[model samples]
Target chain A: MSETGDGSLSPARPSRGMFGVSGSSDTSGFNGLATPVHADLSTPKPYGSWYDEATDHLAEVFGGFGDAIERIVVDRGELTLHVKREHILELCRTMRDDPSLRFELLSSVSGVDYIDSPRRLHAVYHLTSMTYRRRLRLEVATTVEDPHIPSVVSVYPTADWHEREAWDFFGIVFDGHPALTRIQMPDDWIGHPQRKDYPLGGIDVEYKGAHVPPPDERRSYA
Target chain B: MTTTDTPGTGASPTDPFAPSRDTTEGRIFTLVGGDWDSLTDEAISGTEKMVVNMGPQHPSTHGVLRLVLELEGETVTECRLVIGYLHTGIEKSTEYRNWVQGVTFVTRMDYLAPLYNETAYCLAVEKLLGITDDIPERATVIRVLVMELQRIASHLVWLATGGLELGAMGMMLYGWREREVILEILELITGLRMNHAYVRPGGVIQDLPPGAVDKIREFLVYMPKKIKENEGLLAGNPIWAARNKNVGVIDASGCVALGVTGPLLRAAGLPWDLRKQEPYCGYETYEFDVPTRENGDCWARFEVRVAEMRESLKIIEQCLGKLRPGPVMIGDKKIAWPAQLALGSDGMGNSLDHIRNIMGTSMEALIHHFKLVTEGFRVPAGQVYVPIESPRGEMGYHVVSDGGTRPYRVHVRDPSFVNLQAVPAMTEGSMISDVIAAVASVDPVMGGVDR
Candidate 1:
């Protein structure tokens, strides 16, 4: 920690901003101060509260729990299980069927695009267990080149629309989905609009000889 | 729009058959070559079913929602909900703006329960900032009060529109009439009626206005009588009962499997309200019941919603008695908005006193104010999902911050969007008219559904 002239202590870390952009052309002088990032993602056991107990039960039921799970993160009183992309279907079945860990309801499914990271596209699923009254987040990260994850629609029928939405926004294909059509965007939309690299607006205008490049070819604060 | 940019037989807008969506069994569309007899025979031969397209634009849809129904005579064989007509990309838009500016976008998501959107967003942001407990008691009480008031207003709209669709003309006008009072009270407190972005990250935007507590207290007395009158109007009427009873039924297991929530889930006798179960924003301390019904039908949802409005009035009364005077926003200067607004002689609200003090007395305060306002405070990089019991259901905000002034991503789990999935389960094998009652019971606001 560094003590400022006013005797206030601040952390020492790499800086990137106005809006978390690094080495950008849109330099408005908010790129100097270091901000704290909660990077210690993997929480050590004995994870407190119902989280540890839940994880223990999930491990007991699923034979390949260690292989299926990439990491376990607990932050802000929520449990997030980073699951491998290939095992999502099997893991969801275990979560839903096991008596001790009956996560019957898949509350939501969303996606995130971390542009500079190696495994950039993340498909996130929020599962709710009415039997245990618990919530768990299952995250599956994959690269932009290969953005395929198993669909949980068979286990949780509610995943039908949510999976389609994730595919519509971020282009993370949920393999084995019954009919994975666009849910939120028009079917003719050319590119995923929610990726970090996608322009906020003003990229494509359908006029003759209109030259417009997509996925952030304009001046952007991103 | 590009799908119909040009008109021709090949580019015909009527033949919107996308192969990706054509997974139904034995479904085919053969364009008739002006042969009325053959067309009639083909449609009635059981090899082809009559398909009805109701609304991306009809009155019964409540908003812009389209349903494609394949029918056998009067019974619906298949019901498919085609949404996304009202997608505004609010989730993608929030990634580009600062945290304080996010509330404006989120409140427009579930327009009926706008306060719930604001509160859930603020609570998630607060959780990311690690200042959840630092929120003052007065602010929490005000948030609970305003949200419950929003609940009543939202349910009133539900009743109004649902009644209008089901042939109860008087209930439509009466339900909307009662909602205007709640909107007026909201306008008096938050300076706007519909999309009031009053709840901020650290706390609420400002303290309750003068006589706001008394107005809410007055509403607490007035609303119960209106709720009772509504029940009396619809509860015993034979037409209402026939139109609603046992229509559009989905039991508890089906509700949970489809992720249906709010009054619909409670109407299935689950009583799984997040307010009573998870208890955020001092809701655990409030004395209220989670109303439930035995049958999972349209009429049961109506009964549950009516009882819920009474419970909301009870909570609002408790909030009136629990109101205390304190700073509504947080005390931290770096995090709080650098202004204390007051009405000026020019008939505008501005932080004149704060401006004068910063300009004249403290040069440091001036610098702090400029820095804080222009480049907002940084939040620690993390993701959090905060869920609240909205009038419709479990409205959740899954917010991710990258330690910047702006959010990395903001995903809203609108109950309307999730609950609309249950329409097929409710409407299939039922009469065509029950589709209206089913959609109304689901209450999927297209703004929320397509956001």
Candidate 2:
């Protein structure tokens, strides 16, 4: 829920002579003019300086592992960490129990297929720490050939269905899941349909007389 | 109020693992399947238990969710939840559509927080393309305003349904009344009520309409008072307190361990709001507070959402006040089309580019336009993950692009799906009625879950 960069995020200047407030420190205008009715509530802090110490501390603890962390971008108010596959579960476990990095909540687990990239698949974890008032992301890249990642269901019970979904759609196998059944798609359905290479509308063998047109051949409403 | 009953009397006799039988392995040798049915029937009838299906279509489920409940009188012995009644396969279909067209498809999935879905997808695409900063200010403001509005709308539905579950019929009516105003605003801006494809790549579909600002202002002024009135209606009521207070309790440790977020996490006495901690969409600019409660009960979640609506109102007001003039879309003409093209006027090829393409270059403009619309833009070969705080919790997109027009992998981390897991832990030893209260408190929207 990061606010887009509008001037509203920064703390408003008080009105008058008192720091940034108006005339009498009660209602006086910033200048000599009449008092304004309302106060601007938006508060802005220097972005980099605000979270620098805490983030730096975590980075220090991460030490050599920091090099494998590809992207550490903040957007729309979330701090996302793009870690390679080998370190994802360890990072999650550390983030969960570490005093400073108490990301106890494993909020979500899902898979994304980067079919075009050298490492073709990604498992994304969203974690929140109630104690630290922070949120962190962990990402791992794997290829389609061996799309396997350790399951976090042992840590977070909610990972059960989420892992099943990733397996059902993208075909990313959670190695230690209790039951990786198709939660959405029928259990017998073939192919990981959500994979980019999977056809949008496959040949309807039941309707052998007709051909299902590809996406572009259909009518355009726009 | 304590009822002490024997724990394992109902275990099957002929099955040997049945509780009615002795624990030793020697007891198993004495029993066989032939007389087991009669023995189990007699033991079960004496013990008293029943099995009931709550829904693939029950009102308390809030959507098409089926819960199989094994109950011993008023207490639940075991519960199994069944889902997937509304699987549209939007993720599968996304591979077939172009990148831009995927916005409309993803927006329809959650239904409650459409903008969050659109933003996550756009961020992933931008990451893959290495064009994160191409989004313009106006588009950003529109995105913030709409997303906040969606959050408000989503919380309203949660409040409405939560109230209905508590037997407070008036709350649902009033909650929905406020929600319709937000929907009207969405329709006015995006042309659709629930799923608005207004937030697209590079920028939004179009700019806000004239008079949209004033309407939002009026709604902002009117909403807080209505919120207070609704709060008064339920906040101090005796039955409401009794039904909600200690029922379905989950502490902060359990919440964090289970991956819960949004109000549910806040209600557990944590200030882990994505807006405050992560600061997406300029939420840092808005003057508002993240409401939190320590009880971690059904009532606490209800209180958090009620307070969140007020904070959201403050945000909407700030956005409207600062609604300055600027272009909504970014990037050169190569990526996004110029905003001035008329529909029918292009039919006769009256434009210069049309003439150049038709007479000189063999309809190259038409071909490029066709390809752009048909195949969509190809993204670089990479992966990007983006997360947003929707009303449910952390809504995120994990995108993988293979240098193709369609996304190679697009997965949504829907909050409802994550939050639903908290149900079993919350309901384990509770009475059957409290199970309803517990679920309503967590506020799982099955649309997001089943997706």
Candidate 3:
């Protein structure tokens, strides 16, 4: 363990940086002092099993596979294609319609905000191909400043609610969505609650006005 | 504004029964008084397309689902669903807690199928930790046992609620009775009747207690007869048949397009059961059938669910046969919490003897315990999506970690959330009454939907 900026020891391998509420309130002294922890666990060529074949087919069908896809990660025996935001819809349509990659069912669409990265907002899509009995994930990254990713509701109608949910939680705008309204949160609710910067809206546990502070800010007997 | 056809055209400005002349969307009627005559007159004259709001609170809409229906004389032209009335932000809360604490939060999502939610979330965590292979065989068996039991319970609830909504109240009683049998067995095994956070990241919170296996076996014998009785109460009844058959007709293609799964998709005849197709938790070793039906309607869903309960019984029986005496939690000391726990007169608490031994000799053991409970074991930084076949459908957890004790993000692809999208597709062309049957067939728990 090496000393951090505040003269506190910070462990080097497999960092435990983000401990408390992510912004200035973080007193756990674990906030990332390292350079870029998640640089996309990019797997190399011959990415074992079906991953290599899938990428080959994607490259064959969609021109500029290198340009559209930023990296191909095969971690935990799952394939994640980190694609550019502009090509998300194009990639999804090809994935759905192409004979080689008929990922007909759009299983889920989720979002993650990596606050440290320049392209902080990531829209993650999980697609399943019932025919091939295979699963593939597509991720699209965008800057928080311009968090716009093309909608894939045209190709997979199921993505409509999923996209709206991503918009509701992460504030990632899905361009050309039928009705991009707040889904899980109220329409009048103000900022995205799931982003890294958003304060976890919490209250103290209370009974008859006697309360214990929220867990993170509580005193510890360590 | 469709001002061409306005009932209560010349009423007092302050009249309680006066129908406000609004735009083409539809007019708003301020009927504080019971003006039945005026209401009928207004309904007959005030535009052919009448917009009726069913509920954020209606009984038959299956949990806080609001349907905005555009009806043209009993025929629904358009049906739109308004959900999000039950959002608890469980996903956001998981990011704040340690990895093990996440079970309590996730188990509350799909309340009826709580074990499935926990198993799915835990499986994803295990996969992320790369300890999937290290999990003990007994734990895998118990996980499967509890999950299949939850499947039966959840399907029984669907049967109960679906029957009650369609007017067969007797069937509802029978369905819930059988479900109670399973829930009792579950309460004995896990600690609660519902939302049991029994399944943990490494393994189950505890192993099956004494007589739990016998009780499950007893349920295996009892439920098949109960399912048959339930089928007898509804399958032949003319009103029940008429109310259900061809009511919520969503074809296989429709199911695929709308991302609907579980029994609804199986009833549509694709047989896309994740338990069979994507077998996790050693489900491949267990013998069970994926029941399917061709009608793709409420009756078809009813048939599929009943058949599935019998299959769950089969799997539960297999699980009982497979249970071997061994450790339930993993053996790795650093990963496992409280290394040893004792049951019986001690009332299922951590072993005091083990604690004493560790405290007297090993400072490292105390530190390991302290770090584990306080700040969970660090997972390698990456993301993983693990989907399991929940009673509603494919319930998945998309978990991302920044190599930390707490998860970076945990997003649930709740099947209830996805299948609720098919409400419009099923109910739009059908009559106003059929909307209830359509939604009941979908069987969405709003807790999962709005979570």
Candidate 4:
């Protein structure tokens, strides 16, 4: 339960590195700025036109899985269902098979590392229902120690490469993936490069009598 | 001794084909170890399979794309696509820069359709700022115009490369010749032929230059005739028809299952276009049709792309009619760029009048410019995903901001990446020669795929 500058419990610990180097000068000028970490968001009922009906239907259909549904968030005119990690597979199957919630096309599967939260890794799935002309987002989060989520390839075969990509960049393990090798990086490369703590590996540039520091080494206003 | 007495026979362990070689380097090995008659009989029996790698560096792959194929004779038994040779890590680099600088990074991802990338990213930023409605009418119209024009250019590249792959070299020449006209128009407006970071957050970088409209009108009159001639060359040719018809077929169900969209999905008989279904950037007002085909093969994709170019022409004509003179950028000085940009001797820069005002007389204008340029305006803490139809398919940007000048995380769901997943399914059982047609039909720009 380490606390950040704002006194909120953050899972992310301050690294010994300065902008990714083990020991370097801290050139980022952030004394006057405050980094705003987002708290969990929730919306009130009657959440616009199609949102209310969709949530009500989801709740009615998955009545048996109590507390598996953590929360339903409607923000920026989009609906998101934050489900527990264990029940994500069942939820995806139900969402894909249900006639009312036929999200037939899995548009994207992306991973976001929220290093400040208890569940440090988040897997976001964007599902598109061409039949109903609607879109839904399903998210599941897990910690670094136990970053395992069931593969939804059985339900959406398109998740094969996407799951591999997520695993490649975020170090989130998808259990039962056929071949979970790196898709974007070299197979022998070490460390997930997209993590918040991972340093942006940029080198200083020397060009035409001018010297420019790398992005991480440059002054930061955040 | 009698068997080894053949001419050039030397029973060398290092050279397996010692008996057949006339020169030292001419060691030609055969699959059959013992007798040619037995190997020929076995080959005729159809039980041999070989593995071959097509490219990460061959022509006709459209870019640096590698395909590994398992062939039984000439027919392919299995196909595997190996991408990531062109990985630029643009998304990871975007995290370190501010929001305003992100446009330059994203516009390079799908190099064929740079406007779609900028529009999607800007729309997401505006959504996070809750200023979707505040964008000026002229800006939106210009966005629609440039995006449609980009679509035409992208489809023409697809046509040109696809034609070259299928041995229709004349079509390749015609397609590029027609596409050059559009690129000149783009350069006239945006000042770059490719990777034009013209579309900024609040609006475009600058209003359209003079005579740009007349040039577009000239293009509108000239492009249709060229498209007709190009189609006439390939649409009825027996060789082209035989090469494309029923090759690499994926039906509507398969397309949905594999998350394929755009011309690939439309060619599969589903008219699920994001512009028509979701209607971003006031696309609903523009009258056009979503061209579709029932065949869902390489030929269908080719036909759909050509028809789509025609439809884009219609949209561009409407945009020409809808053009009105007004402010392009938003009035809000806080979020909008402070300087009005103009083409200078070196490159594009702030206009002389604004620079003079800030430098000489107006201290307030100087401070405003300094603050806006140094630290960009902050967006509210939230996450949003905005999808727009590019020439390839649905291009989406999932932007997360933590109420800072820089983005927390940004992930681009590029259509080229998603549609490339269907290559294995489409080319698994097809002939080895058909792989070129299938990959070209996908029209994957590897910049978008590997980014």
Candidate 5:
């Protein structure tokens, strides 16, 4: 938290003095700032809004592999498409190329493990489309035994590090990643830390005459 | 630190570890039984490359970000970024906290812009409970106001640090000066500056405090001039422009492929702002334009951010105008408790004016207070994902409940972590100097990245 000579955080302000608006006073806009806009929550939610239609359209694009699509959940203005592990890359490719539903951007790729689910591992892809200004959530489910799915790196290069992260944390392997090494965790780390079944603590490092139990052995404060 | 200028310092039988022509070119008798003279060409002629370890403690990194750089004559051949040194496993920790208490945790994750984190988490929980409508009008407006203010503060840090990275020390100073105004506003309203848990699940922690309106008014007066002064210093300067312009250019297609968003996506000639495309917190009600540009360079990103700051100011002004006195939190006593007044000279729970009625007459008031605090509200068993236009990009929270007070699982899609994926794509093949410019453009807050 070092300070500059003028007592500002950063020495230069790039956009300064170009705009004619006087920075000295808060008079003009603040005085006439418009009334608060009330949100209309009472309107009946359309049974199949445009978002739902888009999801269905994406599903149709993967016709032969339609069985891979498990469930479509639309909540909080986001669409989540749950798919099987084997068909994730294909689904992502289709979603990206489809003109009607161009989910070109894979905004985020992270892994989650539902301890209770039969297929415990899930690689969640948060996709966005620049053209349509719409978002779609693509999820692929796998088991801890073989957490392999074809990489979407060909479709979206950004998936390289994201896939590496998934591989590192949940042990979900992406097949076609050029260099699918660990991104956050160390290179030779043993266990997938984010998985629900995995313990938080490292090995049995004894501390103060007591052998330290694995993370799961720790008590839950709640 | 003796210089081993002597060509061959008496090599022993165990000195096969010595650098030699055998090691460099493998042209000589590369025998295991070679003497010291056989390795003379190998040791001195071998290219000297320096390796610098930049942190897990470096100040410029913002957090415990460690970089191992292989430098050959000031040119980096390879760079390895190491993180998780700041990892608190907040996502895993989220599973054990209740929906209401979860706001406090998420807010701390993106320490710079805590409001966005709180808003995203609450929106997800509200969606799961199907209580989006239950969020009061005043609450939504207040949420929007605070979030936009947080955006300005967050961007100020980005501008300051980005300038600092490029050796423009003055920019860093002005940036913090402006950010302090936002912090003061936060403290006045929420009782804390950085990690204010004001925006909660059902509503805010409480209503806006006394004199919050005037403080915000004063800040609005002070900020614009400072922003203008900052722009004057760096925006059009020949050196700054040369250093940033076209230094790290990534087009729309490239940006899309890398999953980059926010100013980076917009600078790449895509006008995909979440507030414009998918309006949250009643952003649709405000009249503000999505700032976009054609040049996908460091300079373009900086320009877009400057324009965005103006838009945010417009939105903030609008919120103030509509700041008609009303309840900040929802009226559901089941979720929010009644504001209690202080007692008189004789210490007691109730004020002297209403002491008789609270103790003797109103058992319902006592019961309501007790119920509201002890067993917090319960959210139904379900999952919901909510996205908000954070300063970084589309920040979202995916929360799951299992018919209990605590959430079954809570995961945050922090924009910094997500946006960091595009860094190498933006930096590869470009001059190593452009790496700093490109990274500064993405504006990553590493807490969010590591979390």
Candidate 6:
């Protein structure tokens, strides 16, 4: 554990706000407001109707690799699996191939940059199984310095462009992606635009020669 | 331009062909000459190929979309679509504005189906606020009605544009003519012909204007006859059939693998409509059929879209019948919009009564108005992805709020962006002319694609 410079000991694990910008006071009248950290919660047995059976079947299938899964969260009637970055491809393959867990369609692949966390770049995948009329979300996170995850394009060819987009926006490297060049941005464009620290690049609005500053520099609301 | 003809002139300035070079296989030659068959033969074989760039400005392309094609004579060997020409950073812009104002930004994403974009984003924000179940019943019915009308309008544009691209110029007129009636209705309610930010987080911007239901009833009656007229114009015509049938074919498995949805998926014989699969906005209570076709071709997509308009008509009629007088917005004043936004002679503004009360009645009322308008309401810290069936396909908004007035991050999983990826899979190995049909069938609104 490390000291947070205020005589308070930080959590042993990498908690939220570990990497956020320090010393900047919030101007939204919430100056010392504490955002509740989303701690991993383990659901008790019989975790809803199909959620239990699905987890049990997954446990049976990935018997030895069950440790790679960090947490299983059931929130707002949706199931999400926090998987270790290294085992995402294997889990996706199993999820797609297994008849009982036939998540045949990759609904979307997007990246969320949680700059406050140690593992800042979160790659979110939404999988839909038309046969079973079910959907599941799989999430994997990696640090800014070493953000690499195996590409799932082999299992779902539709992930090819999405991986490129994730790479283009959040700078999360998808290893083994066939030509993972920038998809949305220009090939020569600078820095990943979607990261929290990246500037919004909004130009000042000049209406009738009156100047208005950009959104970030406007009246602070945190 | 001057043309010179000379044979075996290695150094002659008039030579029309580049100097031929010897290879292990044979002589590799660049045909700058006027011979057509030799060039076609060489291109057809593995010896040579041509690369062509289609419009970021082409008329047939729905908007600013560019495609790089590798051509082997007239057959397309490969097709690569380059999007993002119209990227406006709507998702990035939402972080700067409050939750209620986000509707104005997202409504511009899919300009043809602006209501769906607004509805989807509002639903996600509502879900994040944990007020999904608290939306008023009247508001839900209005949402259904407005969404169905937008669907018909969007499908009309597709039909008109698709017909014009396939050389039926008259469809452009008929489709736009029928669509104008719906736009009039939308204008009557939302006060904008396009990009109406009518759908809000708690409810719609306002309740239905007087006689709005009767106008919609008139449109419901008038639209079916026009749809039949459109079918009559193209359904039995051999030229249209030849241009569409069996072209741009992708089976159900291919569509699933490529993550294609909406009519393109339905055309491939999959009845996977989000309205039925995962109902939102009280869609489960509405009676309608998810139209599907056997073949996933340009023709099948056309048929599915047309059939969907009829089904939308059915849903609209049901909505009109179910239109009971009730409040359109939620009762929670803290989260609900403070004023009934109305269009005046100048532009949109707070109604006169609201302005008078806030300014003259009480100081507390004035303070409440200022706080709600400036800082907006704060949402609890959380993340949610709400998916809805839009005109094109499944439109999902992944919104994250860090318990603040402004959103932390908002990512729209726009159907156009995801569905546009299937262009290459649909166009490759088809004729050059078929590319138009294929792209039109997918109906990728570049505004949504690039956003």
lDDT of 3 by residue, B334-436 (tens): 6776656676485867777888977888897887787677666777677789999999899989998766677889999999999999999998888998989
Model 1 lDDT, full chain set = 0.84
Better of 2 and 3 by lDDT: 3
How much is the lDDT of residue A19 in candidate 3?
A: 31
- Candidate 1 lDDT by residue in tens digits, B359-423: 99999788768766666767766688898999889888999876677788999999999999999
Ranking by DockQ: 1, 3, 4, 6, 2, 5
Which ranges in model 1 have alpha carbons more than 4 Å from their true place?
A1-41, A205-222, B1-33, B43-45
For each prediction in turn, the share of the native Cα contacts (below 8 Å between chains A and B) that it retains comes to 0.49, 0.36, 0.51, 0.43, 0.31, 0.31
The CA lDDT at B153 in model 2 is: 88
Q: Place model 1 in a CAPRI quality band.
A: acceptable
Alpha-carbon DockQ of candidate 6: 0.25
Model 5 lDDT per residue over B1-451, tens place: 1123243454332345433342453223224444445444543555655567877786667777676666655566666677777777777666554457677788888898899998999888777655678778888989988999988998899899999988889899999999998998988777788888788776776667678888888888888898888888998678889889987788888777766778888988888888988888888999998899999999999999988988899899999887776666666665554444353576424455455555677897555554444434555444556778899988877776544445656767778876766666666555667677777888878888877
The lDDT values for all models are: 0.84, 0.72, 0.84, 0.84, 0.72, 0.83
Looking at model 2, residue B112 earns an lDDT score of: 84
The superposed Cα distance between candidate 5 and the true structure at residue A65, in angstroms, equals 3.7
| DockQ winner | 1
TM-score of each: 0.89, 0.74, 0.88, 0.89, 0.79, 0.87
Model 2 chain A: ten consecutive residues of lowest lDDT: A28-37
Complex DockQ per candidate = 0.34, 0.15, 0.33, 0.30, 0.14, 0.25
Docking class of 4: acceptable
**Residue A215 of candidate 1: its Cα lDDT?**
48
Misplaced by over 4 Å in model 3 are: A1-36, A202-222, B1-46, B343-347
Report the poorest 10 consecutive residues by lDDT, candidate 1 chain B.
B18-27
Report the C-alpha displacement of residue A78, candidate 1, in angstroms. 1.5
- The alpha-carbon lDDT assigned to residue A49 of candidate 2 equals 30
lDDT of 6 by residue, B1-451 (tens): 1223333344344336544555786544565756777877886677887899999999889989899999877889999988878977787878877788889999999999999999999888887677888999899899999999999999999999999999999999999998999999999988899999899999998999988988988888788999999988999899999999999999899988988889999999999899999999988998999999998999999999999999999999999888888888888877888887766888878898888888998786776677677667776555677889998998988887666677778888888888888989888999999999999988889999888
Q: Is candidate 1 or candidate 3 better by DockQ?
A: 1
Q: For residue A160, give model 2's deviation from the true position in Å.
A: 1.8
Instruction: Please give the clash total of every predicted structure, in order.
Output: 0, 43, 2, 1, 29, 0
